[model samples]
Target: MPRAVLRARGALRRALPALLVYAGVRALGIAVLAVWGYWTGKSPHQLLSARWDSLWYARIAEDGYGYTLHLPGGKVHSDLAFFPLLPWLERGLSAVFPLSAGDAGLVVSAVSSLLAAWAVYLIGERLYGRRAGVALVALWAALPVGIVQSMAYSESLFTALAAWSLYAVLTGRWVWAGSFAALAGLTRPVGAAVVLAVWLGVLVALRQGKEHGERGEEAARPALPRMLLGAVLAPLGWLAYFAWVGVRTGGPTGYLDVQGGWGNGFDGGLAFGSFVAQRLFGPAFAAGLGLLVGVGLVLWLYAACVRQRQPLPLLGYAGAVLLLALTAKGYFGSKPRLMMPAFPLLLPLAVAAARARPVRAVLTVSTVVLVSAVYGAFWLNGSGPP
Candidate 1:
């Protein structure tokens, strides 16, 4: 065979496994949701189109915010509860396609998810080896919360932005990282984590350079001006929204109040913890206990971060995600899925698996696939959040 042909074949050989894994996981998730819909006497398309959180996003896409829900306790303000980016994309797509607002959102999410998986592959390949990179991307694409990737949700969009931002940071493209982080902040409140992680990474790199006696002009460091520029740009999206909400509502606390109306306020965890504890110990459902365990796993991940002395980028991102998951009052049941963007938590395990034995790799991948399949089925059956 020609040298070029051999190289091409080798590249395909290396990439095939990851591609297969991604396709299998996604296909399985779709099938499960379809079957569950059939069993529940619901149309799959309707189930997919059902107004849920995605409804709010679709409304924002079609109506451009300015909607409120009145509750018994108080009115829920949703004008700024959701970021504008995804809905904006949905609105733009719907104009060209013969799709409903919700279907448009789902299309955007699904495409973004594929982009996210590719970004994960790029990051892993650069930081680790080709095999490890492939495995990491596959693992992320096939995560147990796989159903979210297909829904008209923000996880895929957020992951696409966050992964690319992190990859830029890893590659020392500080400005690109910051720009993406800012966009991500607009898409989801959790974008703050990416911003913090990037800033921390730059700081660590600078500090280490100074410590290595590479002082003055001799050090190969990014310009302070450029780094600062990126840092300043990263959170502007969220900040702008906050400012707008504050001004319109006549107070800076209006955003928090709006979230509170949905039974989601940050009250120092007393209320949130009690809610979780009751769910874990109550006769409500086993999913509640699952929620508590997920929280505990997050805590354990933080402990692992400390023990591993992981980079500030990873640590900061993980910490921010944990804070949001713990403090957010509403949707205790969806905490696990909501926290899916905290991808840094998987880095340590990815690192370990990269160095594990072949048998270990096989066993780990098998377990992940099986568990993700079951959970995906359960979630799609209307047993959990969409």
Candidate 2:
């Protein structure tokens, strides 16, 4: 057999178990969704590909940008606010295949979600071990909004890019890290987290290099020029989209205006703070407490991640993701979905899971899977992702 064949076999042997875990968890979520659909007379496929942000993405894919709809309240929802990469993919896939843009979007999301799982597993495997990696993927798949990974949203694609970019940074593949980070920027606004990870990792490497030089030791410094090249490339995708939005909308901060039209923008979490305050004293008192608990859990997990000292890339990416998701105004219900890509935050849980008895770990994950699946179904049946 060829040496390449041996390498391929080895890789597959290692990846098979993690992939099985991912597939099993994903199947459980889908099965629950299917049951819910049967009970409610809803179509799971339509729920995944034809609603909410998915619709906007499909329109952009089919018709291109420069489209806008004025709502009854004088708000303009422009396709410009929806990033271009997903639609571009939808368009290309539809063109080359016998599929509608909606179908293509679903395909893109489905494929990307699996790639994201694989990348996530690789990251965990590298940091801890294969068992931890498998647990990490299982935990991620069991997130309450993990169903979005199978939808036509860009979250899955952005996550895949972000995970791979972080993995690249961890492995000292500076160019690959930068390239994926750039693609991530094209995929979602939160792509900045990936860029931050790359830059932070590179900065740390440079500092370590200086320390090694001072001690007359061989410095394994990441190549400054390559890392710089990646850093430069990482922001171009997002910046290019912003520049295009600005030019098209005839405003210097056109992208900001577009996001504002949708009642989204960074307001230092004031809106979120007020939201929590109103909820606490209002009819939704329990809901308010739940929100408080959720916020606390997010923070606690982040603190645990830091205590574990996972890596610079993981910490930077997870911190930036949480900050953006928490601080962004409006879309309170979507916050959980928004935070879905911060897989690093699950490292602490994965580590714990890895140490548990296999049967116990499986049972815990299975219960979460069932809960997440039901929640996803309930969410889709009601006011779904925005």
Candidate 3:
């Protein structure tokens, strides 16, 4: 075998433990989901790949967008609100293989989840150490909403792109970072976070350059072109689609209007706050408490990230993602899944887990894994993954 091939195999071997942990948690979630599905007389795979937004994506893949659902209440749900990259890949994969678009989506998500774990591990390792990286992957996999990572959804793909893009920024690979950011923009609205992260990192670098005078200029000069190119390229994919939506809907604000039709738009968290308030005062007070705790946990972890002095790119991405997820109108139940791509929030936990005794770490992760699996199964057996 060639040396490069051998080396690649060796690297995979080293990374296998983290990959296996991710796969194990995901498998447990799927197994639980399958059991729930059987009890409910439903298909688990269908639930994963053919329901809610998954169906929307696959429909777009097969039919090439321009579809809309008009309700009796005069609400319009346009396929244009969904991003294009996942469906584009699904369409291409389905055409090249024997799989249906839905199946292709599952395949893409499954592959992307693994790649996401790997990229996440690499970032953790780069910043902290190998053990922290491994722990990070496992913790990410064991998230209550981690099941979405394995579903035929865009989260895994977008996360893979975002993670690698951030990694590229951290490693000074400007063009690759921008390219991945652009692809991420094509994947989800949160792609803007990745784009912002790239530019933020560049700005920080430039500021540091000023602090170093001629020495900094000498170091940053050669890479300046690439950094600028990356910043310019980062938003084009999403911008193109946004412009296309504007043209198709015959108004400059068509995309925003379409989102508004579905009760999705930036409301500065007013709707979300109202929902929480109602629930807190209503019969579901306990449920309201749970929601509040979840949000609190997210906020606390982000604070931890900030205290840990995580890289500017990570902070930028995490902050943007949190802001967007929190501020989005309606779809309150989807907040957890929406926040799943903000993996930087988990770094502090991963660091703590890495320092724990092996037995303790295993027990902690195992307990959470079990809870997550059951939660995922229950979530899917009912109204799932909006």
Q: Top lDDT: which candidate number?
A: 3
Return the TM-score for candidate 1, rounded to 2 decimals: 0.88
Please list the C-alpha lDDT of all candidates, in the order they appear.
0.76, 0.88, 0.91
Task: Report the Cα lDDT for residue 192, model 1.
Answer: 83
Candidate 1 lDDT, 215-277, residue by residue in tens: 733464546666777788888877887777789789989777677767776666677778867
Model 1 C-alpha RMSD vs. true structure (Å) is 4.2
> How far is 248's C-alpha from truth in model 3 (Å)?
1.0
- Screening candidate 3 with a backbone cut-off below 3 angstroms (N, C-alpha, C), the clashing residue pairs are none
TM-score per prediction, in order, is 0.88, 0.95, 0.96
What are the per-residue Cα lDDT tens digits for candidate 2 across 1-386?
99969964785578678878787877877888889899989899899899889999999999888788888877778888888899999999999999988899989988898888888988998899999999999899889888888888999999999998998898877888999998999989998899899999888777777777855224453377787888888888888888888999898899999988887899989999899989899999998989999999999999999899878878989999999999999779899989999999999999999999999998998888889888877887785463
lDDT of 1 at 295: 70
Tens digits of per-residue lDDT, candidate 3, 1-386, equal 89969955875677788999899999999999999888889999898898989999999999998898998887888899999999999999999999999899999999999999988988898899989999999999988888898788999999999998998899888898999999999999889999999999889888888799999989999889999998998888878878988999899998899899998999899999999889899999999898899889899999999999999999999999999999999678899899999999999999999999999998998999999999988877676454
Clashes of each: 0, 0, 0
Candidate 1 accuracy as lDDT? 0.76
Q: Which one is best on TM-score?
A: 3
